[model samples]
Target: MAAASIFAVIIFVAMFLLIVLDKIERHIVTLGCGALTLIVVFGICMRSGKAILGTLAVGDFFKKDFWYQVTESESKGINWATIIFIAGMMIMVEGMAKAGFFRWLCMKIAYMVKCRTIPIFITFMIMSAVLSMFIDSITVIMFLAAVTIELAQLLKFNPVPMILSEIFCANLGGSATMCGDPPNIIVGTSLGFSFFDFLTNTGLIAGICLIVSVVFFYFVFRKEIVTENGAEVDMSKFPNPSEAITNKKDFITSSIIFGMAVILLVSHSATHLTVASIGLFIAVITLISAGKDALSLLKKVDYKTVLFFIGLFIVVGGLEETGILEYIAQFIESISHGNVMLMIAIILWISALASAFVDNIPFAATMVPVIQSLASTSGVDISTLAWALSIGTDIGGSATPIGASANVVGTSVAAKNGYPIGWGKYCAKLAPATIIVLAISTAYIFVRYL
Candidate 1:
């Protein structure tokens, strides 16, 4: 058992390194590693004659303990609710995008700030963050990046700084709400936290980070943000925001469905409906309203991200079955001398640094069980540790371009627009703000929870 557990840990670490290096497609790495884990753990169980099937078994392999273990891991490891919820949200966002809602919103904001270059920058940054609070940050960046690129071209200013600021703010904004980021959803649902709980707990800290990041970007980009005609541009050259809408009917329909989804998400505690169910319900309504375009909109949903998450859940589940996560919890507890504050601080900093390079979904999934174990052994409130992990993973991904989905989307958009932002340049520009926000979060955690 010890040898099998050690092997599982090694496989998991190798997978983590490959993911961080990003040399291959993430979904491929995750799925391949997950398969290897299942094989190794199943072989071990079979060899030990511990693979007995229970009364719930229905197939020929049901008599084998290996199959039972596999079933148990699959059931316990994957948070199907969170996965389905994200899928539904993605579908709805796809419908909205097809309707040009995001583009229209971006154009409206562009029109509002066209005359003031600095205000244009700040307004977009805030807009990116705020939009990400309800929608996915990557989608927010997809639309906002296009507008920022066009506006920069018109103003004859570099778009890199503005886009980078938007990316930073989008991630910060996501940390405020449960539906805002994948990591938040995984952590919140796993811990039974409500949307309002996240709003009350992490929302204020996210708002503070957004403000600080905007100020930071202002100072950094002030000199480079000059307009073509001395800080004021010809607004007539810009297209009207209303003209950006391509399908008014679909736009109205999507907006209504999306709004109802948000309302349901907020009232999920009272309604007794899982967030995933609400998202899926809205998605079905969207497809119906989309009429003949429903298939095309459905095709736009990010199935790759959803699959990657499922693969990660299975991979982490293997570790949990092997007792690797509990071992890590014990190691952390020993190092912290069972001090709750110190343990939380350690979890926060480690999660932040790890998430800066690795995907936070897997990191958060793995940490969820470890934090729960730590809480059980230490007799501290699990909610406090959960919040620390949530903030760390959610906000820490802002340190590098590879840290979060929004960062990757923003960078790709910039590169496609002939403003390729190098990893070193991205880190140099945004790492300080990331660190500052993290420090503020650490203080907030200590004051509010500890």
Candidate 2:
């Protein structure tokens, strides 16, 4: 217990630092840290007894035992369904990327914004945010960043503001839908919130934030953009705008499948099917359609992220098993005197600050069970807390250059195009706008859900 506690603390601190620095590859850092966590957990498992570890049936973590003890008692560690679902989603994203869908999409967006830099910038940000509500923020950032670089050079403007705004909007947009962000997906899967529930509640907040972000960005970058000569921009130089794409047919097919998959996700309550099962169905259809090429596409998915998620869950599981999480939740509840609204506020603010300095994915992963336990005891709605955490962690990414993967990737792409987005400058352009919009979102959550 002592060893596990100390190890968790160290890993938590290191992960937070790594995310805030934004210098290293997050997947790589997560892999390293996840491996270390497994090592520590295996040690604890060995010290306790083989029977305790043996009792850890592969699929049992999905059951009531998720909150069980680990003192040489029978235990389980992994959620196989979650692991498989993540693996499948990664493959699907890769398949789409390989099919030249993203590039084509980017080209189309670029064309629509042509010769009108500010409108183009605003339109891209708005659309990117909307796309993020359906797809992963990381994927959206990858596509937008690539196009923003080309558009930046052609327009003779900095890509920093537009890229920054897109990251801001991605978080906001993702907050609007259950499938939008990884944290929301975790919340949806664990708590059984349907897609419409998220859309109806958080979606409205997201729309408000989107409008707020646009207006905020206008003020932030109004001067730089207005001085630029938009008419002189040449669009033809950005050839094949779909250069990063590979297979168009597979792209279209996968997109249609993805759309159906989302519709099914949103209609979860009506169907009574698990997200994991839905993911499996998608994987099967994709494999049938793409065949050997589908298998090849699996390489594009970030498998490391899956492992990292598994490891984080196990680590948090260890905390729950050791009763550490329970203790913290109790401490928080007592401090707030069991006031659910106050508790929600504390969690939201803390999550935002912590997320700004930690990979929101892992941070959200570990917090799920913690918040679940907290809500179970305090009578607070876990769904609202989940949405709040998702909003904080997502939009908080825009508060700093190292805050989110999208910010890192977007800045990197911009730098390559000679418009470097330094930490200080990024903060100057993004922090105020993100803060304002996020504040509006938090207030909405408080008034509507609390």
Candidate 3:
């Protein structure tokens, strides 16, 4: 027990420092931490005369050993559904970009506002947030950030506020649906919570947070958005809307396929059509429409992110497999005195606060086993607690620069537009809003569910 606790703490500490340093790629950092964790925990157990190998399979421990070992380990641990969904979504995204769907959509929105910057800014926030509910937050952040930087150049306003709003709303919006955020996906699959179950349970809260988010943006950025920077931005100089809509048929097809994919993804718990299967089906049909490009789209997908997830899973899995999570769960349970509501609050608060500092994916992944143990020992129904964890960690991701992938991408987008958003300033803008929402969410879960 002592050995497991010490090793888990070291792994967590090392992972946090590496991420904050910004020098190491997150996947490498996580993978290294995972490997270190397995060695220390198991090495200690083996030295202590415990038959650790008897408990852990050769296939699970050795990643490069056998093909079936690697395959089975991944099949059991990795979220293939997410990987497939991301791959399929990338194809649709590529088609959209190639078809100029994003440019067309932006131009239409810009044209509708008649080049009014404030309204255009608000529209960007709403659209980014809405899209994040179905698509990945970081992808939406990248597109929105690129477009907003362009808009900043077009509108002659600082891109900082617009980028910040987009990032903020993206995090908040991703919390709306199970398929929206990585942490939410982890919660959904591990807890056996349906996609609809996530949306339904947290739907109202997320909606309320969305409304609050809009208001939060208005106050936070009102001065910046209304400021006259240099001169009027001539939208007429930007690319014409007509030129942006080159492939109307392809655009329509991609849109339809994406829409159907969203429906299928959300209906997964009922239909049992995993996101991976749906993605494969979509990828095949897309290939049939667009030729070999659709099949090749898999190469463009973010395998690194998937690898990061895999490593993080193994890292946390080692902790659980080594009994660290059980120790922490027992400690939490003792402190809570078997008070279910107190345990829920602690889980929500700890997960949220921890998420703000480190990557929420690993944070949430690590918490899964802890929460499960707490649930079993304390006699708590983890269904609502899982939702609480999802909401807090997903939204808490907005509180800091290193919190989520979307935050990092959004800030980078801001930098590209010559409007640098430093860690200090970005956190200052987001901390208050995140704290308020987290507090409300924490109270909401305890009061209603408890």
- TM-score for each of the candidates: 0.91, 0.85, 0.85
lDDT, candidate 3, equals: 0.74
> Per-residue lDDT of 1-450 in model 3, one digit per residue for the tens?
576767777787788688778699988987888667667765664353232443223343243322111111122344445555666666666666667777677677877787677887788888877788887887788877887777666667777888888888888888888778888877765666667887887766778877787888888787787536546656668767767776888888877877887888777766666555666777767767777565556567677776777667656766766677888899999998888777877887788788888778878887777888877877788787788788878988888887888999998878766778898899888988898888878777877787
Where model 2 places Cα greater than 4 Å from the true spot, the runs are 1-57, 60-77, 230-248
Tell me how far the alpha carbon of residue 356 in candidate 2 is from the true structure, in angstroms, after superposition: 0.8
- What order do you get sorting by lDDT, best first? 1, 3, 2
Estimate the TM-score for candidate 3. Answer: 0.85
By TM-score, is 1 or 3 better? 1
Displacement of the residue 113 alpha carbon in candidate 3, Å: 2.6
In the range 1-450, model 2's lDDT, one tens digit per residue, is 766676766765686577557687656665566555556644553354442353233545454423221221222344444555666666666667767777778777667666467787788888888888877778888888877776666667776777888888877788788777777776665665667878887788888888877887888776666426535656676565556556667877879877877787777657655556666777778778888786677666677677666655555555555556777788879999987777877777777777776677777766777787788898887777777777777777678887777778778877877778787888887778777877787788778876
Candidate 1, 1-450: lDDT as tens digits:
777687778778878988878898888888887766666754554243232111112232222422111221212466666777898888899988888899998888778765467888889999998888889998999999988898888778888888999999998889898889888888877777778788888888898878888888999989878766575577888889888788889889888988898898788767666665677688789889988988998888878888888668767877777778998999999999988779988998899998898889889999988988888898878878878898899888989988898999999999998999998889998888889998998898889887
lDDT for 434 in candidate 1 is: 89
Total clashes for model 3: 0
| Candidate 1: stretches off by over 4 Å | 46-75, 229-231
Q: What lDDT does candidate 3 reach at residue 382?
A: 75
Summed backbone clashes in each candidate are: 4, 3, 0
TM-score of candidate 2 relative to the true fold: 0.85
Cα shift from native, residue 277, model 3 (Å): 2.3
